[model samples]
Every structure is written in C-alpha cells, then in structure tokens.
Target: MSSLGRHHDPIVAIATAPGRGAVGIVRASGKQLQPLVDALIGAPLKPRQAHYGPFRDATGQPIDHGLALFFPAPNSYTGEAVLELQAHGGPVVLQLLLARCLEAGAGIGLRLAEPGEFTERAFLNDKLDLAQAEAVADLIDASTEAAARSASRSLGGAFSAEVEQLAERIVNLRMLVEATLDFPEEEIDFLEKADARGKLAAIRAAVDAVTARARQGALLREGLRVVLAGQPNVGKSSLLNALAGAELAIVTPIAGTTRDRVSETIQIEGVPLHITDTAGLRDDAEAGDEVERIGMARSWESIHSADAIVFLHDLTRLADADYQAADARIAQRLATADPARLLQVFNKADTGVSAGSDGRLLISARTGAGLEALRQALLKRAGWQAAPEGVFIARSRHVQALKQTAEHLAGAAAHASQADQALDLFAEELRLAHLALQSITGRFSADDLLGEIFSRFCIGK
Candidate 1:
C-alpha cells in the first residue's frame, strides 16, 4: 500500500510477535486519540502515564485486565497522540483486544497498520531520520553481539551526526564559492583569501575516513562468502564441522559423500563469515556415477562465485601420481580466479609431513591447528579493521553515497585548480556533493526509495 495518502488515518496493531507471550501490546497512533481512549477505558487517560484498567468492547463488556498508556500529540513515537494496551500474552486475547480497538475507534477511521507503517510515520514526523530509522530494524535483525551494538550506535545518531557534519562543511565551501561568483567586481581573490583549496582537501580527507569506516560497517552486516573446495575426501567436511563447532555435514572415508553444498555461518571476532562446503572437485571421466559428476559440476560453480576459496589438499596423498595430476589440473583452472581471494591450505598436518614455507597454510582439521590463522587471514582479505566499538552499522547504499560524494569533491578540486579558476563549475560540483550527502539522511530522497526502504521492515514497527 502507498504511504502517501493514508498516513493521517488512525492506525492500530498488535505490537508484539505473532505468538503466545507473557504480555502483548496493542498500540494505536493518530491525532485526537482521546475519544478512542475514553471508549475503551471509560475514562480519559493521563498523558505519558500508565493506568491499570480493563479494556472493554463497544457493548461495555470487559475484554481483559491490562495497563493503558496515553501519550499526547507531539510527545509520542509517531509525533501524534498514542495509546497502548498491555494484556495477557495469548494469541486469541490479543486478537480480541485488537478487534475491540478497531470497533471502538471505527468512528475516527482507525484501521489496521500496514507493515512498517509506524516507523515510516516516525520518520515522516521527524522523530527519527532515515539512517536512525533504518537502525531500528538493523538492531532487531542483528545476528552478532557486535552488530547489535553497532546498530544501537547508529540508532543513537552516531552515523547521521557524522554525515551532517560533512554536509555542513561542504555547504560552507559552496557558499564561499557562490559568494565569490556573485561579487566578481570586488577585486579580491576569494580562493586565496578563504583558503578554499585547503578546505576542500580537508573535506575530501574526512569523506575518505568516513567511507573507510562505512565499508567496515557494511562488512559486519553482510559478511564474507567463503567456499571450501578440494578433491573428494580431502577433509572439506571436517573443516566445515570444525569451523561451525558441529557435525553439520556427513564425514567419511568415501569420495563424493556430499552431493551438494553444506553451508554455515560462523563468526570470528564478531564478523560473520558464510562458509559453503561444496562437493569435491574432480574430472568427469574419473567420476564413479552421474551423481558424482553433477556434484563435481556444482563444486566448480561454487568456486567460481566465492568471495574466498580455501583449497584443501590431503597431506598423505601428495606423492600419488594420479592425485598430483588432478591437483595440477584444478590449480590450472583456478589460475583464472582472483589471486587475492585464494588460499592454498594443506590438511592432515598431523601425519608428520614437513610443511614447506611456500605461502600455503598447513593445518589439521582434527587437531584444530592453524585454524585461528586462517580465520585472521579471511578477515584481512575482507579488509576488516577496528573493533565494532568504533564502528556504526552502515549499508551498501550508504557506502555508495559516500563514494559519490568523494567523486564529486574530486571534480570540485579539479575545477578549482584550473587556470581560469572556474568558480561556477567548482560551485556546481560542491552542490552535487552536498546532494549526495543529503540522500543519506532523507533530505533529498525519492518517495519510491522511502517506500522500498520501509517495506522490508516487519509489521507494527
């Protein structure tokens, strides 16, 4: 449904998950909620106070004993008068309370809230900006402790504050440039007097720093995609089980035991890493059956799309001629993959074989050796730095906006250094940069983008 037309109508919904709980809340937000409050409780509720009472239906029959809270307009979450009913945590009980609210509020056009309508209203009412509003959902959906903390910081306006500061600086420069353009007859070199070049340089540096931190935040939220691949029976499943600390995949001495990908998400230092163990890689001619060939085909596909690959090799089979030939062929094929994202690891290190220092990792999945190093290596590959304490949760779109701002700043710098001193071009570039920053805080956002962003949120929030 469109958020433009029906935002002013009174809305009510159960504010808790759809299940039995110790207590459930039926929340309503709109202007002039006093009538609805009186109809349900038979008395006017004091603003911002909770009163113990019984909710009643239209016929004055008690629905349930609960706490009623009333918040006057401009003092509530959605910047409107609000009412909350706390009742026993039963699905049927909550439904009854909700129906009662709708029935009693029918005169004021009260209706069920759409998904994310409440938070969208909060955003529209200036109770929260776009970034902070997004953090509300991020906090709820965070998969790691560090992620939750970072999202909390964002919700508290840490990220938005920084973006606003950057925007303010850009605005100051734009004003200086435009002022110089307006009064060219005043024989004064505005660029030299105001030190516009130095200020632009400083702003560029600040934008770069924010971009770096935002990339880290994005990494924490979306994690790296790692794929483990090797010949059959090369301890791929064992490594997966070890990383997840569970027997997620069947491990045996038989080849082609896994006919599909076994995926798991494991966190190292609060950074999530999604690891997928694919079927072993081998030639179709050596396949025992069509099923194995299909699995092997899938393995190659996983390897091609992976963000990182851990190529495991059996330590004991290094001397076997047939195994070496297959390994060489796989290595040749992997030559096309990204060298920065690939790691060659030798498994079964407990067999007492001397591991050479050829930049390959040696580990035994059984003994858990070198796994910590591997984890660190993956984090390094993903360019994760700084603890989550100093980082605020950010999405890929935020990163893209920051990058666009930087590019515009670069264009501004180029225009500033020209022989003719193209102040008009410089001012235009700064204006573009300012707009890029404004999008992050919803200052210049499109209505469709707002709809899309809020659509992902759960109902009643």
Candidate 2:
C-alpha cells in the first residue's frame, strides 16, 4: 500500500534537546540529502556511514567540524534518504549548521520539521501504526514504570493484535452467515444450527476480554484525579505531604495557608495518583475578597471535576460552629455538584475519633493512621489490578467508541429477537461496530486523526 510518489521532501531539524549539552544532532530526510551532504561535509556520502567532515556555508567556508551520518532512501526514518550532523550543543553552532543545510538543499526544497512532524511522516510511511504512533507519546509522558510498560506493550502492537484477532473472528462468522446467501433453500438450517450461535457467543466473549484489559490500561495511563477539600487546616496539606512522603505543600497552623492548588503525582501500589490540595473552605470576615471567591470557585471545580474527592474533616473541631457550617456547605456543594466521584475522610483520628462510617474512613496523616485504608479506597475507585501484564492503554475516545460498539451490538441482538433476521443487515451493523473497535487499534485510520495525534509528540520520538 505504499504510495509511489509520497516523498515528503527533505526535512531538517535539531533532534536533541534545546539549549547547551555535550552535542546536538541535526537530521534530514527525503529524496535528496545530497546537496546538504555535499555542502555540509564537502562530499557526497555513503549510506549508513559516519564520516568526519566540516560543515560549510554557501561560499564553502567551514562552519563547524563534526561527525556526519547518512542513511539512503527507503531505509531512513521517513523511508527516504536521511542525513545527520552532530556538532557541539552550543546554540550558535546548531544555528550555523542548520542554516548550512537549508542553503545547500534550497534548490531541492527543504522545510523545517514541525513539532512531531518526523513521527507523523513515519506513521504515514507505514513505519508505525496509529496505536503505536500514539504509544510514542504515551511513553514520553509516562510517569510511572507501570505506565511505561503499558505504553511499550501498546507500541509493540499487543493491543492492536488483539483487536485484529477479534475483527478477524467477527469477519469469519459473517462469512459463514453469508455463505447461505447464494442458496435460499439451505438458509433456515444454516441459521438455526447451534454452531452459529456458539461462534457469535465466542466473538462476544473475545470483545469482552479486550474491553476489560483496555479499561485497566486506561486507568493506569490516565491515573486518578484525587482532590482534597475541607475547612482550612484540617490536615489537607499534611495528607498530601504524607501520601506523597514529602513536603509538597506548605503546612502551618495558619488556616488558608495554601492559597493555590498544590498538586503532586505519587504511586500507591503501582497505581499513579494525581493528588490536588486546594484552599480550604472557611468563613473569614477579614479574608481578601478575591481569595475567598477564588477558593470557593476552586472548591466547586474540584468537587465536580475530580475523579474522587477526599473530603477531609477535623475530628477534634467537628462540633465547632465554623466547622459545622463547612460540613453543611459541602452537603450543599454535593447537591449542586456533578453527583459522581466523591469520598469522605475524617482526619486526626489519633486525637480520639473512633472509627468512620461504612463508606468513610478516619485517618491521622501525622501518625500514618488509616493510610492503608485510604490507599485501598483509591485503588478500588480506579479499578486497579495488581498485575497489568496484558493491559493496553486507552483514551476517552477509545472508551466512547467501545461503548458505541456495544450499543450497536445490543441493537443487533434486539433486532434478531424480534425475528428480523436479515443477518446480512445485522452483519453489516456488526461490521460498523467492528470498525469502531478497530479504530482503537489503528486498523481503520483517518489521515487527520493521525496528524493530530503525532503532532502532540516530541520530535525525534
């Protein structure tokens, strides 16, 4: 399926990190790197060979001396000719070398690489599939070892291979059903056979397996967004520091100390946790109007937008008027909030609060009390498994697609129950659903989607 004239022209860019380092790399790919090679190193280069050379300007003066590597067509990153020049990482040196390549290849039309343009080219050239291309970004953005491993599985096509297998099974069953289309007489017996239902059941089971693992992968990759909210100085900051095991938040006896949202990512038993501590709710007459207003706004946001809320309560001060008022306010927030992803926690149990209700937990962040219960609560919320051996990362788009596909399948089943068994029509519906599942794995790709995805990746990925 390779296009014959799909050379994207030569693109040159700095692959290494910006700013000074030991050395910086300048890379070029396309049909013609000869001009750049000849001008930069003063000679045409052999494929995959590293040659010592001096990069020159248009007038043939030395710009910088360094090692040059050349990869010829159909074997490079973009499936075309590639050239690399490594020079000192100084900003001045890289600029000089890049200017040289542009001038040398100007006649052949060289363009600057956009952010992730190189990887997008790789995807277009069939060097990587859609899922693998996305995995490139996931791998870069992975925070924990588990996320990295899941992303690696995605890149290796473990996820896509599962989808393809399921798609093939669905197609085969459709083929069996379609086999009776030519001979109307044998259709009833063929459709009534026990084997037909069994095959459909097996396909359903496979879909279920793939979906469950994809869900696990998604939870791992995206992590849980846990927001802490309570009256001022109820140990919200202390809990963040305890869970994070570091002073990520400034803790003091002074209430409303944390004026801004402080966030930290910590792993609790292989599950990545995104914890946010916001300004606590309180009634302060002398408080800055903007600060109170902003804090109240953020409290509402965290309550509704968070994946889960750890509603901290100071056990010692629960009877206090201001603290009681804060609790009532939370009840009001919940009534008006998103009505999903909420949890309640009573902190400072070491000060003598016995135990929490069935759905709540009491903890002392200072003494590490109730931390295990807290961690387990989060793990349960995230649907985290101990071992994500076969997990494959999924986006919200993937989740929504799978859901739609399931809906289509449900409709097909209902149609069949109503005795409308023009299974060719049913099969086509299944096919659409199957295609949606395939989109998760890159089986049916759109050019624009690929563009958007790889454009978010860092260059040289």
Candidate 3:
C-alpha cells in the first residue's frame, strides 16, 4: 500500500512482548479513535484518563478486563488519537484483545501495524526526528548498560539538537556568503569585514567536535569484532573462555580440536567485543581432513572481515624450529592482510617463556595474566575512545553524513579563500553542507532512506 494510505488508516498492534507477563498492551493509533474506544469499552473515555473496564468483542462478550487509556490528537505519540488497552499478560488474552481491536476498528480501516510503522508515523508527524526515531530501536536492542544510556540520550534529542545547531550555523554562514555574492564589487572586502573566515573556522571546529563524539557513539553501538587465529592447540579456545568468563568453547590438547568457529560477545569497560575463535590454521597437507579444510577457509574469511585479528602464539613453542617456520608463514600472511588490525599476542607465559620483541604481548589465558592489557589493546585497535557523559548512540550512516558535511565545509573554506572570484562557489558549498547535516536530522532525508531506517524497528513501537 502507499504510505499515505497507510498513514490515514488506523493501525493496531500488541505493544508488549509475546509472552506472559504481569500486563500486556494492545495499542491503536489513528485520526479519531472515539468510535473504537466506545465499541471496546461500551462507554466514552476521558482523554489522558485511565478507565478500568472490561474490553468486549464483536459479540458483546467480555474479552478481558483491563485498563483503557485515551490520548487525544496533537498530544499523543504520532500526534494522533491513540487508544491503549492494558490487559492481562497471558498470550491468549493479549491475542484476544488484539483481535477485538482489529474487529472493532475494521469499519474505520484499522489494520495490523507494519514493523516500525508507529514510530515511522511519529517521525512523519514531527513527534520525533529521524535520529531520535532510530534511537528508539537502538535503545530496545542495546546490549550493554552504557549502550542503553547512549541510545537513551539520542532518543532524548541530544544528538539531533547538536546536528540542528550545526546546520543552523551553516545556514547563517550561507546567508552571509550569499549576501556578499549578490554584490560582486564588494564581495572580498565585505566577506572580510563580516569575519566570514572566522565563522567558517568556528563552524568547522564544532563539526570536528560532533564528529569525534559520533565516532565514540558508533563504537559503542557497533562494538568491535575480534577473531582469534593461531595454529592448533595454542590456547585460542582457552583465551576465548577466559575473555568471556565462561566455558564457551571446547579446549583440548589435541590439534584441530576446534574445527569450526566459536563465537561469543564479552564486554570490557562497557564496550562489547564480539570474539570469534576459529579453527587452527595449519599447512599440514597430510593432516587435512575435509571438514578441517572448510574450517580453515572460513577462518581466513573471518580474519579478513574482522575489525581486529588476535594472532595468538604459544610462547612455549617459540624455540621449536618447525614451530618458528609455521609462525613465520602466518606472520607473512598477516603482514599482507592489513597489519594495522593485527595484534600479536604470545600465550602460555606462565610456562616460563620470556617475552618476544616487536610489540608482542605475553600473557597466559590459563593464569589470567595480562588479559586486561589484551582487552585494552583490542579497544585501541578498534579506534574506540572513552566517551564522556551524554554521548548519544550513532550509526555508520550518521558518521558518513557528518564526514560528507565536513568535506563540504572544507570545500567552502577553499572557495572562501578566493571570495572575490568564488563567492557563488562558497555559498553553494555551504548550502550543500547544510543539506548534508539535515540528512542526519531528517530535514532532507530520502523516502527510501526513511523506510530502511524505520523498517528495522519492532512492531508497535
């Protein structure tokens, strides 16, 4: 259906989770919900007041006894009339209540709400901007306490306000430049007199500050993907268990015990680390089984795609000639595969093995030695910095948009340097920069982009 058609129709959904709880919510939003409310409760409801009553079905039989709430238009979520039925939490009871809403509101064109359609409606109605709408989902899907707090801040408009402020500054600068562009004779001198250059520099500095905070937020939202790669029986599984603080993978002394990838997510200092322990990488043609070959292929794929690769080494075998040869081959492959994301970690340090040179860290997963250092090193490799309070949750798209804004600002600065001959160019650059910033707050977002963003949200939100 067309978006306009969907928006005009009354939408209903079970707002609470699918299982039994103390209470469940069946919510509906529309232009006017008095008819539906009257049909369900068999009485009129006061706006913003909770009316304890029995919800009835089409047959005039009680479906459930619940609390009913009526939110009038322009004051409710989605800026429309909203009706909420707080029913008993049994799955059957909620389903019955939901069915009754659909049946009762059918005459008014009520239908099941599409995923995120409610929040999408809220965005369309100016109840929340694009970033804040996305934060609703981020807050729901947050995996850590810090991530939840960041998402909450974004939902509270912290991120949108910053973007809007930057956009406003850009707009003001564009007006100044455009005014100067209108008079070619006094363009250069007028721009200098207005301190346009100083304002541009100040705006750029603010953009840089917001960009830095957005990077930290993106780190919190997406976290880091780290893969552990080494020869078989090198304590890779042991390290995984130690980092996760759980026996997530099987650790055997036999080579190739882990013939597949074992994955776990562990948080360090409120930042989640998605760690994957891959099968041991070996070049033994005689020992290659069919399953082991596939496992090794997958391991290489993980290494190439990971945010960081932990190249684990058994310190006890560092002196062995054969082991040294294998380690050299692995190092050569790593050197070719983005050395910046690779961290050399020597394990089994408790076995009386001295540390190696070349920025390698020596630790023992068995003894929990140097694990904290390894955690810190992983965070560093991911380019994650500790964010200050009130940092909002951000996505990669937000980062890219800010980057585009920064580029446009840089272009504007270049044009401003030659204001006498390039006033038009400078004004155009500032306009483009303002539009890019608007994309973050939904002032200039594409319809398809809006669809993609809101489609990820759960139904009833």
Q: Which candidate is the best by TM-score?
A: 3
Q: Which stretches of candidate 3 lie over 4 Å from their true place?
A: 1-5, 185-188, 284-287, 356-359
RMSD of each: 1.8, 3.2, 1.5
Candidate that beats the other on lDDT, 1 or 2, i.e. the better one: 1
Candidate 2: where are CA atoms >4 Å away? 1-7, 283-288, 336-340, 356-360, 418-420
Per-residue alpha-carbon lDDT of model 3 for 153-200, expressed as tens digits? 999999999999999999988888777777667535856788988999
Ranking by lDDT: 1, 3, 2
Better of 1 and 3 by TM-score: 3
Candidate 1 vs. true structure, TM-score: 0.95
lDDT by residue for model 1 over 1-461, one digit each (tens)? Answer: 48657899999999999999999999999986777788889987888888998888888888899999998879899998889999998999999998888888888999999888898999899999999999999998888888888999999999999999999999999998898889889867877889999999999999999999999888878888999998999999999999999999999999889988999999988888999999988888878899888888888888889889998999989989999999999999999999988888899999898767677788889999989988998898888885747799999889999999999999999998982368999999999999999999899899888888898888888
Worst 10 residues of 1 by lDDT: 415-424
Instruction: Check candidate 3 and list the clashing pairs.
Output: none
Best by lDDT: 1
Window of ten residues with lowest summed lDDT in model 2: 1-10
